[model samples]
Target: MNAHPQPAEDGANAEHATPSGPPPARLLRLPEVINRVGLRRSAIYQRMSEGRFPKSRSLGPKCTVWVEEEIDAWIRGIADRGG
Candidate 1:
C-alpha cells in the first residue's frame, strides 16, 4: 500500500456511504399524495390552483411529485387547526 492514501474515485468509501448531512427530502407521486392527504386527484389539483395545497414539482413533461416533508407538514397544520 502507498504511504499516502488516495481518495476513492468511485465514491465507495465508508464516509461517503453514510452521509452526515440532513436526510434527503423524499418525493411523493400524485397517487401516494392523494392517498395520504385523503383527497381525490381533482380535489388535489383544485386545492393547488387555489393555493391551499402544496404545489407539486414537475419532474418532466408528464411527471410530477411533491416533497413528502411539505405534505406531512400540511397534514400536521390541518390537525393543529382541527380541520
Candidate 2:
C-alpha cells in the first residue's frame, strides 16, 4: 500500500483519521469565514462594529485573518440559541 493514502472519489478520506477531536487552533482568512458563515462582507464589518464577531488579526500591511476557534465558537453559540 502507498505510504500516503489517496483521497476517495468525493475527495474525502475513506476512513476516520485523527481521533484527537477538533483542532486546538486554526487560522482562517476573511473569504473563508464569509463562505463558511454565509455572511456578506458588509455584514461581517457591521458585526465587527457591534462587537458580535471575531476581529481579524493583522498579518501585514494588507493582510488579516480571524482565529478559527473564535469563529467556530461563534457558530456554536448561534446554533445553541437556535438562531
Candidate 3:
C-alpha cells in the first residue's frame, strides 16, 4: 500500500507545474503555517489583524496561503528580538 500523499488533484494545492514538470514551488498552507510558527489559528489571525504577523495571500474565496520566505523571516525576527 503505497499511500504517499497524492499530488494535489485540482484545487489550489494542485501542482502549478507546466506540462514540463512540477511548479517551481508551493505556497505554504495554514497547517504548515501553524506547524512552523507554533501558533493557533485564532492567535495567528489576531496577530495578523494587529499587524504583528505576516499576512497570508488570498488565492481565492476559499484558498489562503503564505509565502515561506515571509514566515521564515518572521521566525528569524522572533529569535533576533530575544523571544
Better of 1 and 2 by TM-score: 1
Question: Residues 3-80, candidate 3, lDDT per residue (tens digit)?
Answer: 544556554333453465644555899999999999999999999999999999999999999988889899999999
Q: Give the lDDT ranking, best first.
A: 1, 2, 3
How many residue pairs clash (N, CA or C atoms closer than 3 angstroms) in each of the candidate models, in the order given?
A: 0, 0, 0
Alpha carbon lDDT at 67, candidate 1: 99
What are the models' TM-scores? 0.77, 0.70, 0.68
Tens digits of per-residue lDDT for model 1, 1-83: 76654556765654456676989999999999988999999999999999999999999999999999999999999999999
Worst 10 residues of 1 by lDDT: 7-16
Error of 3 at 77 (Å): 0.1
Which regions of candidate 2 deviate over 4 angstroms?
A: 1-24
What's the candidate order when arranged by decreasing TM-score?
1, 2, 3
Candidate 3: clashing pairs of residues: none
- Every model's Cα RMSD, please? 5.0, 7.3, 10.9
Local error of candidate 3 at 76, Å?
A: 0.0
> How much lDDT does each candidate structure score?
0.91, 0.87, 0.86
- What would the per-residue lDDT of candidate 2 be over residues 64-83, giving only the tens digit for each residue? 89999899899999999999
